[model samples]
Target: MGITLVLMLIFIDSVSTFSISALTDSRNSTTEKEGKNADIIRSLLNQETIIRMALQQNVHILRKDLVTIQEKLTDVETKMSRNQVECTSAMSKLESRLLILIDENAALTNAIRSDLENCNENQLMSSMEIQQINQTLAGFDLKQDVAFTVGIAEFNKTWNSGTLVYNKIISNIGNGYNANTGVFTAPFGGTYVFYIAAVEYEKQDLGLDIVLNNKSKVRLIGNNQAAYQTGTNMVVLSLGKGDEVWVKRSYGKGFHSHGVPLTTFTGFLIKHV
Candidate 1:
């Protein structure tokens, strides 16, 4: 019994030691698994921290670019406002200059119109004056015509030195000559021409004188011994209105004979002053 007790004690000791060893191995394995799980969780926490830091940096860059863009927009708006103001000022000045030019042009046009009116008035007055002068000249031309031609029908007689009378009238324009007195009266102040002609009876002397205002101006004589002697005289004299011209016998008594009424006198006005 003692020996069997001793064997049983040995067996109990060996079993107890084996059980303790197994329990220790099991505990060590559990601790190793727990350590590996803790390492994996730490790596995941490190990656999450790095990603958060990158996101913060990108947000900061974006905010700076937005501020720069806002500043550029504000500067452009200010420049545009200043340009608008300058343009408005230039337009106002140009409009004022145009108004001034229009006023000047209107004033100049008025002045030119006045000058033209005055010129037309002056031309009208000149035309009226010219018409008056022409009318006066026409009147003078109508009044100044004076002409006369006279002759004697019978002249076979002798007479003393006296005025010769021409009895027959051929032409008497303006009635300037008297057929009974053989005298011509001037109708206007002008130059006058007179002609006297006489034919003496066969071989007889004839003396005739043209008298202007009772003054002898020319003489016609036929005293030579020639058959049918003839004499003629012409005189030009300046005569006033109412001046007289006549033919007269100067020295020889009249043996003046002409069957065809050859004794003649004529007077006419040449020009008027």
Candidate 2:
């Protein structure tokens, strides 16, 4: 403002001096000369006044422009600073949130691991319980704690003594089905192979059919039935525990009394190979 004022003052002095010189020259000058000087001075003064007014207006406009520029600069700087602070705060908040999530994830992982360990423990316990149950089932089949096998004794349908000791006999088999004299109960659970032999009234055309309970196995003698009177007829079978082995003789519809005893062909429990 002070520099603009000094410039304005200098411009006004030059215009004043030119106007004074024109007035002095006009008094001793021709009409054209006076008019020319007067016009020149008037034009000069008008230009100077217009220039001064333009400068003053320009100065005021420039000052206001500068003030506006400074205010805008301050606003921009303030906004930039605020943005930087906001960015920093947002970054800090994001990092804290991420750390918290990581910690939570770790805790969840540990919880899952603990649950897995508990499941494994339960599995082990269940396995032990199953083992105990199987042991109990295995013990159920044993009727006696000890095993005692006596020697074999000869069985005769008529009468017998010695180790045979009168057990039971049924010789009056006529028609229909013939039941065995001995009934051995199952003592344990295992495979048992039985052997039986029958002596019939010798009908060369009769067939001897043998069947086992539990469908353990079946043996039929149709081949030797044709040679019944020739020699002893034998049948072999394999059975399971609690299986009843029975034999029936069919002699072409005759008064048959299978003379060949059920014990003639003997089969005892043999060890599994």
Candidate 3:
């Protein structure tokens, strides 16, 4: 409001000054001549008056625009403040969830250890231990056996041999090994560490392609680089029994095998349980 008053006062002052200048010019031209030059001067004075009026009007509009701009700036600042508060709140909630997950994982690990001590030593897994596994294998029968097209052994049994124990296995794959297929079925409910080895460790490192049952996929190694000898790139996926594991190789590429010449390799599931 105070700024509007100042702008109005400046406009009034400019109009008064222009009026005085026009009066002076008219008196001077009348005293000199009432002829062609005088008419030209009159026309010039009129143009100058029109220009001054337009400038004054533009100045008034500019002041109004400035006020509107200030209001918009205030609104933007308010929204920014609210978004900052929301982001802070979300971060705090996520941090709380992380702490809870860590605690739950620790408790579950302790419970598993206690049960393992009381179980039979030679038995791979007690019937009670497989209850959770059955839950994972829901809608599928554990008593049934699945046939293999690629691998020699029923991997489910190998993977679920023991609750706490996992083994590293070497299998025959491709022309070197008897089994040659893109698909491998999981025998048990545990995670399996699938590794591929190089024949001479000098072959091109055209990484392996691992496809999961749920259509999720990951590349073992990348293109153009040789496979890292003895380096294991794996995923800890929560897969149920009877789930399929596959290795698809591009560029006629295959993974390394153990000292035994299997194109693809298999082993124990590496995990906490």
The prediction achieving the highest TM-score against the true structure is 1
lDDT of 3 by residue, 222-258 (tens): 2322222322243446556667766554333333343
Cα lDDT tens digits, model 1, 54-133, are 87788888888889988988998899899889999989999999999999999888866765664465457546645754
Model 1 bad stretches (over 4 Å): 1-144, 255-259
Residue by residue across 189-272, what tens digits does model 2's lDDT show?
443334333322333333333345523243333222222221223233344456554433433322123333322323333322
What lDDT score belongs to each candidate, Candidate 1 first? 0.77, 0.47, 0.50
Per-prediction TM-score, please?
Answer: 0.46, 0.36, 0.32
lDDT score of residue 20 within candidate 1: 97
Error of 3 at 107 (Å): 1.8
Best by lDDT: 1
Off by over 4 Å in 3: 1-34, 120-273
lDDT of model 2, residue 225: 24
Clashes of 2: 1
Q: Which stretches of candidate 2 lie over 4 Å from their true place?
A: 1-34, 37-41, 141-273
Ranked candidates, highest lDDT first = 1, 3, 2
